[model samples]
Target: MDTSASPLSQEDFEEIARAAARTNESVRLEFLDGKIREKAVPDGYHGRIIEWLTKVCLQARPELWLYGDQGLHVEAYRRGNARPDGCLARSGAFEGAGEWASTEDVEMVVEVTSRDRDTNQRDRVDKSAAYAAAAIPVYLLVDRGNQSVKVHSEPEGGRYAKVNEVAFGKSVSLPEPVGFELDTAPLLGWVG
Candidate 1:
């Protein structure tokens, strides 16, 4: 759970995305096959989920490196890149100079649902597909809107074939990339 308060500035990669996305709006842009997807700033609940998920990630043994706002490359999926709300990767995966991590560098990706249909759709469908397409072992979706946590696994044909969904008070197990039994009970109060 090594977190940072480093100010968010437009790094070279972001600059390239800005130029590539062809927009000046203050929205997060994801590049995929020369097309850009816009993601608005998350609201309070979404932000809190990032903090909470990071906390859970850090508690796991053999501590993997955690990231809150880092972008992961899914170039296998038409040169795509996604910034999950929280992510865990094997240590030293980012040793060299690189703004984005390749799919293989990541263990799992987390996405907290934002308050909108578009964001919900992207988190559940688009991003999931991209992650699966890139063969990321785990994809966790925190649906504050639905009051549940959905864990997708067994990537196959651009989608995860296995899924385990549970409500806030229940628990979900994250395998492989993250071998942890994440308790969602604490989220009940905040999620409500």
Candidate 2:
């Protein structure tokens, strides 16, 4: 795929996304690496996993909040737009921002894989690159397909320098900026 030449410009994509949102509330669109893709409307288990993470984050860091399905401007020069499953930042970080908020205040971004064909490319690969390029401190991916959690950190030159993976039952430490240890044991129940 030639990422350099996208079919729709950034502005065009944003307008289409807004229209899609207004017309069909369930349809979510994302633009990454010069391609437009539909983000799957999460299922029951997916919602539960996000809810579980929200509780843990609130308990560990009362000062921060995890905003669900928050739209964000990502990738180099904010060229890509993504709606992360959870975006962790100081409370009210995006108070006045519109549908697509800058990644400046985002400490960490999380993606819980949906049961769809695009899961592997969208969540595991493209999103990681986009968040890292936008310089988000952490990118936590709960990959249901692999039954594992992948923590990508240390962004440098548009990519994460470190990526650590652990199975569903294991505990993983989400690094600094979003300092906390995640107990992923409950994730076993959330996957099909």
Candidate 3:
């Protein structure tokens, strides 16, 4: 309910997010600092990046599913649920069609940074460590404000060993859970 609590109850935040996600038409909800926040999707810029990512990944790996602005909960950490801009997950016989991704289910997570440096920092710093701790490989940050993208990989003991930053005109590829690459020029073009 408040933003000052530690290890906030997932049930509380999840219920709030679930309600907001169902009713709010323009924004998606996620919990941070024990409070639920709504995030607006930038259609031309951020949405385009999600579209391109989905198109490319689905074309190469038809069995894999790509989702944008979807909620993922790492129950083990009581971090509540986080809504990444885009995410990739491999399919399996045991996985269902409408289930949330478990720690082992997610492959890659991407976040497109807005003008807010706080958001950029949160995505790049806090969630980066959270993903590593959850053992999710390949965390990508699309930083439109700086005309750059950052790729984090090689997770070892709750942190990444390498972080590769690519500029707007450059191309970058993910290293694990499936090697996927993209050109940054097209994705960052809509920023302006």
Candidate 4:
């Protein structure tokens, strides 16, 4: 079905997204790189991973909160909308901000891979690029598919200039704005 004359247009996508949000509570919709896609409803393992990460982030930086399923306006010029698994920012950063908040105050965005065919393109590639283009300080990808954690930082020219990947049992440090080291050993249990 032709959703719009130009499906890539943000205006058209937002209209459709609003309608979808009203009609469907079972799935989340995202607009990235000119395509609208459904984000998988996270499973139990996904919830555990996010819970663990939230605890870790809070313990390390009490001033910031890891908000789950926070909608954000991503990509250059805020042309795309994404509901990341977690959004870390100073507490109340999004207070009073309606759905699809700007990325300005977001210190980091996290995506824990879902057990679905779209995980690779949706999480590892598309979301990473969208977050970088929005100039978000850090993008943390808990990649269950590869049994690894990928940290994307130092955005430049609509892409991350630095990427660090470590196996689930290893420790990885999130950069400056999101200064913290994650002991990914706990992650191993959350992934199949």
The sequence of per-residue lDDT tens digits that candidate 3 reaches over residues 1-192 is 456655557776766666766787665766653456556556566777788778888886788877766567755433746778877876552256343456566788888876553675467666787677777788888777777888989877778888999888888887877586677767646775
lDDT by residue for model 2 (42-116), tens:
999999999999999999999999999889988483488999999999999999998889899999999999889
lDDT against the true structure, each candidate: 0.75, 0.90, 0.70, 0.89
Off by over 4 Å in 2: 1-7, 75-78
Residue clash pairs of candidate 4:
none
Query: Which residue pairs show collisions in model 2?
Result: none
Superior by TM-score: candidate 2 or candidate 3: 2
lDDT of 3 at 35: 56
- In order of appearance, the predictions have TM-scores of 0.82, 0.95, 0.83, 0.94
Which candidate wins on TM-score? Answer: 2
Quick one: ranking by TM-score, best first?
2, 4, 3, 1
lDDT of 1 by residue, 60-154 (tens): 74557667767777877656767788778866666773657676778888888877667766788888888899998999998888899999998
Candidate 1: segments with Cα more than 4 A from true spot: 1-16, 19-26, 32-34
